[model samples]
Target: MVLDKFNSVRMLNTDALQADFVIVGGGISGVCAAITAARQGLKVVLIQDRPVLGGNGSSEIRLWMLGATSHMGNNNRWAREGGVIDEIMVENTFRNPEGNPIIFDSVMLDKVVSEPNITLLLNTCVYEVKKSAGHKIESVRGFCSQNSTMYEVTAPLFCDASGDGVVGFLAGAPYRMGAESREEFGEKFAPAEDYGELLGHSLYFYTKDTGQPVKYVAPSYAMDVTKTVPRFRSFNAKEHGCKLWWVEYGGDLDTVHDTEQIKWELWKVIYGAWDYIKNSGKYPEAETMTLEWVGCIPGKRESRRFEGDYMLIQQDVIEQRHHEDAVSYGGWSIDLHPAAGVFGEESACNQWHSKGVYQIPYRCLYSRGIENLFFAGRIISVSHVAFGSTRVMATSAHSAQAVAVAAAMCLEENISPREVYSLGKVSELQKRLSRMGQYIPDMKIRDEENLVKKATLAASSEYHFKGFPADGEMQALDESVAQMIPLHKGDRLGKVKVGLFVSEETLLEVELRVSSKPFNHTPDVTLETKTVSLCQGKQQLELTFEAVMPEEQYVFLVFKKNPLVQLQYTKERITGVLSVFNTINEAVSNFGKQTPKEDIGIEEFEFWCPKRRPGGHNIAVQSEKDCYVFSVSNIDNGIDRPVQSPNAWVAELNDPAPALTVRWDSAVRIGKMSLFFDTDYDQPMETVQMTHPENQMPFCVEKYKIYDGEGRLVYEKTDNHQSINEFVFPEKLVTDEIKIVLEHPSDLIPAALFAVKCYE
Candidate 1:
């Protein structure tokens, strides 16, 4: 190697590259955008300032990824975001069930690099942007510190996913920081100046046990918890990482420019908290415990929100307003943090839940003025109050997916981003996204080319409305419990029988409840309430409600709280069915019910949530007559999850070999096939800090085989653990008939499929 010695100043090595799409910041949103665009055959360049991807979810700053399935603590059932983010989540759960941040980093890297169309540049920061005529971005300049190289990447379309809107700012995109006035958007939930304007930044640390006495020396900059932190007494040696989410600062200051200052304050607070645990003598249990790992970088929550054609406001979320250009959905509550952050006297956050998930319009994804620019992550177009709900990682990633697909379409048509909406192409975009497993509320996949749509479908056996067998443990009715059973329109739920064990003779109260809205899962409207006397023994009680369902939806057979009574649970796991208990899960701030002040502009509703796996058994209940709809035609309903109805065809529990056959009058050619399976969308697969009991979902299909018209095996798969299984044939498959044979996930669980699509 020859070393260069020059009298003149030498510049860094410069490289020029061109791509169809250029995305700055390798966060979850950017990663998802790159993967999606790459999958659509676009040459993409993904740039990251950090060494690894997953911005907030990276090992350097480990924050759990969450979205619509808000910790599974709210009434939004089966509300997980889909598409590339869904694949990443399912893959993370399968490979890193333990939720190691390092492993998660690898998972992100693996996904991005696995796509040949994507070129990832880690440890690279974009500092310059070049714009062309007509307000379009032509290129961006970035530098990699490790390689000491300057890269000028030119692309037709550009996306800004950086946490602070770096590219958007440099490109002169109009944006707003902090809160908007209540009168501006008529948002009553908007924060007052005294309360807070902008949400703050948070830093987290992890601790572990050393199995011996360990000591720690606080740095000179370490803060004094007793003096500086008002909530210092709340600190416990057991709490670590994101559990200390309240350990935040930098909201009152310039979050973007003063990030370093904020990070220093966070570090001081963390060290001081640890010092109190080790030196304060308040915890004898901490003697053997020591600091295991600390986050190097802080997880930033909010900064500058850029402008788009439409700015999502408070009412859009609370009212569950539908958007014709809807591309994604969000269910997280309107969460806001105080500007004073960890040092504030106010509550750490104020969250208000809506009745159901709301649609995110495509107009809010791309910049309003910048013709070629797109917005992703926390920087998307929304009012400050609405940002509280749309700022989560999963929601951001899901929205960014819309950008990826739009960018691909733009490149193909040689048009601007706004033209995709103005030209009436939103429906086609929605259909494409749904086919790729992106869930859009009230939107159905209308792919006319799907071969299954024109074929006759039949299943070997269908699951009738029978009660779950009493095979699991008994659960005490300390809190209200409800079994979510699906009922069709005009169907009458006559009499129901439930197995219960009573300690003493007591009065039992039962109620039949449903949501005021059809798509909502909240059991707010009570149809009928009945009171019955119980004896002190294990017996089946008959509950006669005789309530007629006006519309097709999931009704709750609610059992009121009774300490003396215990309900029987069954081990069977079925798609679109679950048991919810009215209780407190402080993690997501669900305290059994939300009783907000009437003037706060927030509605009051009870929160009935399901438990995690290895538990959350179904309640054993039998109906006098079958009312559930589980037909073979459901497999072609264009819906992949349970919405107003159970959109799945489930085989009977006793069927030894479950099979579904499709027949066509004439032979059809299929070049690709996609299968949708049950993966329990209710389970919020948090990427970090949460450990799951099993590597794969118990309801996911593990084995299946597909046969053609000639009774010859076309394809077979085993060890399947994902919700969407896709196969592309090198040679087209021509057949007049197709058969699918499946093995039950377990003896107690039935075989279920949401939808099937065969495309040419």
Candidate 2:
């Protein structure tokens, strides 16, 4: 088109988009938030600054995702995070077992892009937040440099999944940066002196074997080859992304504003560190290895945190306090790193584990000042000390899912997030979240839509001779392993059943110990040790302990090593058990190690309490109210986690051709039904999980068949790979009774299943 030749100049195009929810950030939290909200039937716009999904876990940063289930993998039996992140882990495990960072990135993008209700905008950074009246956020503006467009997105609600909490920042929301003083939040883990310092950013590098000797040249801008930075002993050719987690910086300065400078320093650090490893002759094994990739963008650990309705603190975590509105559980230790970062001298940070799983309330997820604003990820309302545990990505993702569901409830009810909390609608929110596969510690499901809730059990599943299924295959626990056994006021303990192996004549000292701090989940206080000698071979031995019991105290059973004697260990990684090392020669220590060298939660080694002849327990198909025996029967307990003992159901191991039937009260129109099968709750589904038994996961219905009333065959499935199996019928089936004929997956072990529900 011919226009007047008026001074032509480049124009800035501003595009406006409207959605029900505007989520800023593409981190796991943001991804989960968007997915959860979108799945709940809300139009969502997810703006992420990076080209790819996964904030820290992306190929750019490559920080491994560790969450409420601490990486150490001890006493975290069922602490694996579920929700949206669980789906990612399962898919990633199946698709990218080698743990390729790029594949993981693709996995995240596929999930985000596949959601029909989600408009995922990658490489778009949301910088400005527009707030309307009454503490409400009207919209946010993001600049996408790739398309050279500025998007002004308006929504009824906003979520700051941005790790930096930028949306909340611009919305004038009350937020806290850096560490609060000890007196500010009464946090015991807070620094003795007040400081506006936060955890630092980290840089990492990957190396690959070239198969031939490769020479390296150091960049001129690289730091000193060996002088400025330390850690000579830890730096090895084998160590890569996660092993070098301590390569951090930029905590002393402003992490957000001074990002470029930090990035520069990190780049130089990686080069110089690699130079030292290759040229300085420190690592001899580097001769054939070459640097494959180096990260330019630093992974941030701490930044601006929004002030929400409640500030989670140290007392809540250590005391294992139960919240009425507890929406998520955090089992990770209080891991607070110093600001000195890579230049620091001592170990990374001060880590303190919780005695048991702690609760994260819904109150801390929404803005206190910004009425329509909600937050997830590391930016949730928590003191720096409390943030130590909640900052992990998995925990943050759980928080994201919680807020997203809450946001849906808000949108449906036409109320603010604050109203959801003030009106005591948290219970309803918790019920909804649990129904969606979120684990709320003390919550129970009461959904009227759960058709299984009304069904009466008319089945064949043998009762008695039932107990918690054993995680197949156990090895000798040569290391120090202990469990945080709960003791009542009158409980007595004298002996424990242990699988012991001896290579030569040796003795092992067994003892019971308690955590040094009454609240800490560590076994540093030794009560006593009993020594027993053994000969060469494996034996089921009964280790005796003095009848020394304390009132309502958390204690650990300590086993000392004799080199020749090794106790049998199962990789189950059971909850309530802890592994203690380095305590043998230390005067004072924080348990053995918070997450010393493991990526999974602490290992559940084999050490059993001596019992009289295994009287065992029973699992009967009772009323639907009490479905899974040995498990608390309720709507709240879904397969998100295996409820420790008997997942509340009988395995038809000893029965002949078992068939469990659900007789409904009346004809219920059902087109889709969901069956939650047990997938070895004792093991973990998280990427951090280590076990991979050859057989199918415990209680997984490898093969099953379904039938309607009148014994009409309706459905049959074989070799199912997923835990949550869903069946959608082309035409809705109006039936009063539905039956499942269980074909035991194993002849020795019962084919155990969890929950069965129908959706209309």
Candidate 3:
């Protein structure tokens, strides 16, 4: 043990530890990375600076998990992240449907603890690095304030899931920060001039009604909103939690280095805003509401992004560019926030979506210079323009899973992260990922062991392939409709197509307005509009309006309310779409209703009564109008999962025992059979903010039986969760025919099965 003190610095003795992989940061990305590696039989040590997991989604920060599937919206379609993130999202929905923060923390922690190979060290900050020759990492030293322990962790592989890319920064990996110029990435949305500004940091607060009258007092540090804060004067006492993502600051300064100052400044603003709500004569409704929670940690949006072999740019996202080594995908939109933070009067940020979700490549997951350094989360190698979409937690988590799988391959191949690209190990890596249910855009199952591909699918019940329709149900003429219309980045508003119904001859006016800011959904800035008269009947209307704008956070296409007319919409709640009965009426849009609300159908997101109890859905897809789920077979014709359901064998069931019997032309030795069940493909996963309950879906196959070619019962199971189920045999079943006898299909929709395969 050695101790040294120099001037004003003190160093203490350190402990030594070793693992196959060391993950810095416990955010979704890091957590998923650690789990993936550990699950693949690698030893891992995960170091989180904070006391809890989930990073931004932690109770300390409380930002909900956002990802590749933009809440099952138009852009991303059926995309919900798979692997560990999907597990968390599904579990969180069932156990913590209210999207409770502490519950989310526990869920994430439980997942980490479930992995025996993962060594989790919470409240440990990795501060130093040790590198050896060959440009490879040797070890990293982290300090734990909880126990005053300085520990050195050594690993052959390292992943910087840390959102700030701290490991890459310490390892001398080349990186970039702040906005790029239009000339740098050929991004039209990029600032015409280069700037050292970035998306800001944000703070949030929580408030609850005391039930009885409650008084408020201002702290000494609370700024007087009427004087100190002038730009945002609207301090509604009821608004709290993540609904206030706009309470942002610190973009103009160094978001990483100046984080403390930003925290202090955000504290002032949050406290001041609370004080203004209680002390100011703004409203009498504030009398009963009490300050419930104030954040100590600020939720940071952007920071240092490490350099990788290929830097993804805006055009890649805008054009939905196809990368040869595509590994993961993102579709959250190019969500760029303003540099001025909260003080700026400009739109909070600029955002543009792609035609659809775009592919993220393998080259961007590992460092270009640092031999063993790989990164996930917001730090992945992407231009500032591309980061807007890749930086979300879900996309980063997918990258982490990709890194974890690649790290396993690296261990197997005895190669550096750079070498994997050169040796063409990416295809194998992609195969491994998809077999595990991670959806890589355009990547499909092509393995010869997928025996079902060569078999004849026979079922007792017939699955009538209905042509998918744009509109499923007739909505009642109850309220005005305004949907968030997203455009590909830098694209203009060419037109909008909507399904409408008129009970009698009626006149209707549609208005398109740009979202006020990047951080919120309230519409402002009128664009183009039109008025149309329709005869009594159902009609598909196309409203063509021209507008000039770089991009939009979101656009509001407000359809005027008419008593005699109604619009068509899937009652199933689609992600990314926000429904408003009337923003002006407090009752119409209150986050906290006077009484606890009931679990309404995805239909509640609609202004009309939620009547549809979804029988089966991948998610309520807004487009890709086909009666049957699109491109269900493994062959990809541009559209796949999230945009279309997987190629699955489904049946329309009325028989007591319905079955899908796979028969090959000849007998084949089969020792084991695996199946990926059809859980709700369109699972509306939410982390902390939701109006509905996440429950253990009954839509899965609850019971099933297996039979041999002779129709002899071989295996049977009842009460199942839709995870991959594998049946193994001591000796190979030398038969070409196998059958699945299914019972009690939930939701009464089509009985569906995904990824059926036989392996020896």
Candidate 4:
């Protein structure tokens, strides 16, 4: 080491690199975009200002990754966003079911590093953006604080996922900072001036018990929360981290430039809140508890929403409007917070949910003015009311996947983002995204290249609708419960028997209900009601409904709540069968039922949601006639998950060895085979702080073997727990027949598959 001369102006080391895509944020959206782009043969550079990836989802902030599933508090069934984000979430649940934030960090890091086409730069913040002619971004400049090095990254395309829109801001992209007026977009749910236009930033803290009393002293800057915060009494020792998402601030300030000030204010509130818990003598349970970790950076809810070709507005979300170029979907409620944050006297948030998932168009992904710039995450083009639904991590990540695929198409065709629409290539883009497991609502995969379409499919056995056997435990009728049954348009619900334990003679009321719309799961329309007389002890009660299904959809056979009655549950888990309860999950703002004010411009509906595994067993029922079918033709129905029907090929419960065969008139070369399994998409696989009962879905196939025309094993896998499994052969095989042998996760759960795709 040599001593530096005084006043010697030395330049920092500059490193230059080139890539196909430069994503300027390591949040879930950016991480997903990078992974998807890299997988599509694009060289990518992922830049993160923080020390780790996952942005708000990282350990530094610890916000749970949520989206369409909406905490299982709404009626959106099988609604988890898919693609790269799904893989990351599944991996997190398998490795860290305890939901430790640090372990989640490693999961994200591992996925990104595993891709050879990606170069990740952590602790590097992009500060400058260089633009070339024709409004295209030429390069970006970033500096790493830890290494004291500056990096100049050049790429054909750039993605601005930096929550605050740093690249878009410096690139002169049109954006909106606050909420838009109601007249501007016909948005009736627009916030008033008093409620504040912008959503705020929040900081979270975590606590734990040391098994001994711990003392805490307030700093000089710690404000007295008891005196300053109106909702101070709401704070307790039981909840921490994102559970206290309402513990927020900085909505009234410049969320971007004044972030440090907002962070300091949040710190003051957190410390003061802790001080009250310890010194105010209100929380005796907190005596042995101490602060384990507190977030230094705040999680921003909204910032600069940049402009795109078509801006998504309120009607797009509330009305579930269809888009021609639909590339993704969002199902989370329109959730907005007050500007005053924790200090506000009003309720922490106002959330309005839609009847079903709505499509997100591709036009809202790329910048309207900038040629090569793409917007990801909360900064995408959406009005304030629509943003309330699309701003969540999973939804944003889903949209980012659309951007990744669009970027790949752009590189392939050497065209601008707008040209993709002008040239009528959106369908091709959708097909590619669907192949990668990106869920686009109401859109089916129509790939002509899939060889399975030209072949005949047959299964060894198909499950017939009998009933769930009464072999599992029983639970009290503490809440209203219903069993979802699938029916054809003209089918009538016949006599059904349910096993129940009645304490005494009771008149149980059974009602048959269905959703007004075929796509919705909310049982809003009641068709028939039957009063069944039940005696004491365990007995079977027969119920018959004179109602015929209006369309091909799911109908709910509901049992009214009776405290003296208990219903028997079965261990069998199926792909599209679930028992939902009329209950409250306050985390997602589902308070049993939603009854909004007349002028709020929101819908009123009941929340019928499924419970997590190890508890969400199906109710025992018996029927003389078959009501549901699991045909082998469902494997090539284009639809992956269950929508109007089961959309899955399920084996019979007694099938010892379930197998599927595909045959052709002549041998054809096949290079790759993709199989879509049932991973219980209805449950929200929260990325952090939410423990799951099981790592692998009970309906998923655990092991499988594939054989060719010669009866030689081509590929086999065990210990599988992913929604999609792809096998690429090193040498293309010519086979007239292909057979797949499957193994169920357990005896109770049968082997099931959504779709099978083979390509040459």
Candidate 5:
């Protein structure tokens, strides 16, 4: 084979093209920079040396995307955001439902190509950089494999997101290659006195289960597996899907300098280990599972670092120092992989820090010498010891967000990276980040509005009914009877009742509906007799009722039950007297009934049937635990009260029915509220509506409800049904009370409303 080199220097037309910014390296950081700039309406050109976009996480390497932030359900802090990363996640979740690595790579590639503003040059390598006077980068030249052509890319600004800091190195920027001495940076994990060897890299692989016997062949030059000790092991195969081992660290070669050599050694170790497992016959089923990957590119933990405006040191991390320019945060402990030359020892050389978080400043993202250039990802300026903590992909992604935003700001303001550090511009950048949902605790927006109002009710030692008078004198059943009242149970009551009265002059056209699950057994307490006479303009009405106590609880009254009461009774010494009558006034008129009948009179209703539990009559008391209350008064729209269902008759009812209207005296502000309904018997959720009352608009609602078996509505609301009407929140609200009317239009089991959450 003959190596071909055409020429050392090639001239290209400079005036042919122009861009506001140019990004080198199509990794996550570079892509994010380009995307961020483009989203701000800036012209951007992204150049990549490889066919794929993701640097470490790509099909070429098959490395999993790990970050400090939660992706899917993985809760890693400093969760990053760039439309590009979000696009990749969304596409991956759709294309590869199983989340296969190969498909994930494809999703990443799609995002790069789909961005209209991004011009991606694949299979291209940047060879040289040309600068103008005074160390300002002029143009970058690269060799394109696809066209077999060399081109010059000239832009006002450039970003080096390459994991190895290749562009910054060629640009003659100040940088550090290895760890600093313990005394130099005062880093606890640093080498004794001087910077020397660095943490080596690793080549990760995985295997899948096929439930059949298989065999693995060891490489002829493979190291003996019996001699190597496992570093990381997981025995719970079911939890992790399968067994995984990350045993060896160093291959006795510089990962960046001798990548090919390290890859070869890793391949041998993988096959050799598998061969040992297969030959041992300890895992008969292991034969079916094959090595899914060899050494995809070696993942380097340490490399060249571009000197930035500020050098983040280990002390800064260990001290938990806060900076006005803090643009990102990292939580991973200080983990230093064993250095080269320390191999095959009983005690692996490593250092671990206590659980703590660190703040990384924005000044560390730009090149110190290269005024027009910025650096992000693993190559940011930091001592090797500090880099150990910041090198994690999640932190790197956060750094990428900082770099992208700064780059865009630089382009828009016609300034350089150095200018961003002046006049508190860096802090401004940090503020912009905080506004974008980046977790910067110092500038957090907290909810301070009081959601519940303070109220004091008159205490009753003996039952002195205040609202109305009965024809017969009331008898005191027991002293403990007052304690059974839900309102007397202290501040934390699960539910409370508010009375609503309409006079003869008031014409009510209200729609009352409860947003929570309805109850079965009607309360034995009567609200009509409990109502007070209204003075034309205003009237105060009070109702006395009991709520089964669980523990000390907070309760809020949203609605009151009219013509409803609860009965409390206990077993007596007299035998065979198993039932008691807790009745209301005989003359009190029922809503739909023209004349009250003796049998239809309000009486003690038992929650549980006798067949279910014999002699358990005390458990049959019908209180707030057995029914939901909703009311419509002349003053406002409606009120809703969610009660616990003890009778279990309404336990199967998933949605709230439209029985009456709830009117509020004034427009109430609801910051956030959710309505849950049962759609299917299995899922039983029909719909969920979350709205902001102050804005008088819907935040989100689920339309297509889920159902369960037996045609019961499982999930009442569907995703499509739920939608945010507007992004902006208004000051005032249209209606104080939100009416949730359940309609069982479909031939499915009646859906029940489980809960409603109102957050201010």
Candidate 6:
């Protein structure tokens, strides 16, 4: 790929580009605005200064993307649809394998990237926006870092998504900073009089597991925090020490204007805390852990808010007043951190309101002067008292969505934002958002009964239950006991049912079972299969599985299996299955491995099983290169090893050219496995079962198979390819052992191998 010249100033001809809307900031709000406009078929240019898309929640800062619904105790309500936010979530799920940092960023990114009409320019900063005499933005001038060029971008509409309202400020848009007197907005929490004091900023950090001891050394300029503070406000005085408390150091510094000083102080405090930790030796096992994050950029809690058509106030928030122009809701309390100049405990306040939630008006999101300009995020027009509640990330995200929709409306009508509002286009905007899966509960037009019915049907269709009754009954029915049963999908109704088990206690014990077919297996893969049983006032069950190779094959588990209950297999990847269910049910499983298959060049394989108790069983198989052992057992521990192979193999070179092992145990049941050759690498390999005589253990084998690009089998073992050992073994086996090899015809690389398992 040819690289573009860096730092070379150049400007593209204006005739080559066209966009109906331009969104500055590239933060959550900007990205959402671009997505919403693009989805409406309006071309949009989204300019972000940072390389990464998310602003505060980006990996660089690592701030959590809190939404309005989040503070309201319903996190799902934020970013309800797969817009820019949802895309970020999906991407984060893939990028950040260990944690959900990237998930948050990717959710926002996905929306921007997936939109056909959105043009994203990262590493670009908009320094100036030119407006017409009528107070309408005509174009924006941004400097691109990659090309070192400044370009003038023109669009019919402009949006200010910068958390600080940088674009609005440059465009001479009216905006306010700091507190408004309580009298101005009738806000209960506002100060009696106006003041410039604002909430201080913070430098957040995160840590992970550390196996070894860690030590911290105080910085040279570290202050004696203990001497300068009042008595500690302990959450749990008896059990916890106030180490984290020492890290707090901000007081009297303007969060926005004096950010540099604030950052320096925070750094000193951090180093001091680390020093205290090391000297105190309280965290001995924290050596291997990482700081993960440090004070890179200070998170400003308060800044300049662009003045819009209407300013949302604390009165509206406390009263939960429903406004005709309301676009979003906030449930977080009026949590006003101490303004600059307060010290120690006096610097913070945590007063919270009861069940009530605040409704934010739409009029507070667009510019009061700039006709085509709109604002979202923390900069939305809200009084200090109301800003306390709406300032949370969740509320900001909802505000983004509202502004995006309003922008789209403006683009469609080719009118100013104020005109859109005056024409009562906000209701249509809300309706459009609702159709896109945004959770605007107030705008829901569907009846409660219809919504409930749809939800009920979806729940029933996707629900799956597995386990055995403790009483040894095949069937059990107890709504109360069954209430504990788990579902694979959807939110838990907090109601479950168990059939065939009965107990005097209100909560009955039951064991759940789950199983899955191999990914490359024949026919359609059975994602999960399990049987639950309840016994001895407790639940106990055993799951046994085996690989019956009809051809050269590959197989693996794709379901729950983890002792920590933190791991599970998706269709194409492994992930933590942690969700709302874990909190309610204390059940966990173990990780299991993929199934193994081999070439037999034979018609069939079988073995004899000696009957024993209905519990664990062990099976052994020997190949020309190794001996494989598998053990299947039933335990009441609820921990299933889903990712681990039940069988093990040690290769021995003197056996037959194509080795085969078959075993039978009541504890094990045969599932599916496949084999692939180089020719079928880009196609689906086929499965063919050869006839075999019945025995204590019954199974079949095939000679050859073909594979495809998607790991699917295309051609089955036929009479022409009757020999399993048709291919020559390489002179030197790269590894010491021989395992299942899947050859991709499209590539020169050798086949992939997997472990083998059989029924116990």
lDDT of 4 at 292: 91
Better of 3 and 5 by TM-score: 3
Task: Give the least accurate 10-residue stretch of model 6, judged by summed lDDT.
Answer: 679-688
Off by over 4 Å in 1: 1-4, 7-9
lDDT of 1 by residue, 425-513 (tens): 89888988988899898777778778899999989999997678788888899999999999988877788888899999999999999
Q: How accurate is candidate 1 locally (lDDT)?
A: 0.91
Candidate ranking under lDDT, highest first, comes to: 1, 4, 3, 2, 5, 6
Candidate 2 lDDT, 427-512, residue by residue in tens: 88887786656776544456667777767765575444211233334434445545444443344445456566688777777777
- Write down the TM-score of every candidate: 0.99, 0.83, 0.79, 0.98, 0.57, 0.55
User: Could you give me the TM-score of model 1 versus the true structure?
Assistant: 0.99
lDDT of 4: 0.90
Off by more than 4 A, model 4: 1-9, 535-537
Lowest lDDT sum, 10 consecutive residues, model 1, at: 1-10
Provide the lDDT at 641 for model 6: 15
Encode model 3's per-residue lDDT on 441-517: one tens digit a residue.
65554665566666776667544332223545655545555655444335455655667778889888787766433
Ordered from best to worst TM-score, the candidate numbers read 1, 4, 2, 3, 5, 6
Q: Write the per-residue lDDT of candidate 5 for residues 1-760, one digit (tens) a residue.
A: 7644776775543322467778888876676667766765677788899877777666555444544321111111113332334334434543554545566666666666666877777887888999999888998888887777776888888888778777898999998876677677666567542223566656656666767755567768866656653431221212111112133344334556776776666666666666666566665556677655564676666678888878888777655677777777764445565543223443333433322345788888888898888887889988887787787664676677677777778877888887888756876676445333344422332222222121111111111111111222222221111112222222222222322323333322111111111111112222112223333332233334334323221122212222222222232111010121122211111121122133211121211111111121221122233222111110111111111211001112223442112334555555543332221111101010111111111111233332212233323333322111112124323344444334432222222232232334
In candidate 6, what are the lDDT values of residues 589-634, reduced to their tens digit? 0011111133211111111111111211111110112112111110
Instruction: Compare the candidates by lDDT and give the number of the best one.
Output: 1
Q: Clashes in candidate 6: how many? A: 96
Q: Higher TM-score: candidate 3 or 6?
A: 3
The runs of at least 3 residues in candidate 2 whose Cα sits more than 4 Å from the true structure, single-residue gaps closed, are 1-10, 194-196, 462-477, 480-640, 654-658, 681-699, 742-749
Error of 5 at 166 (Å): 0.4
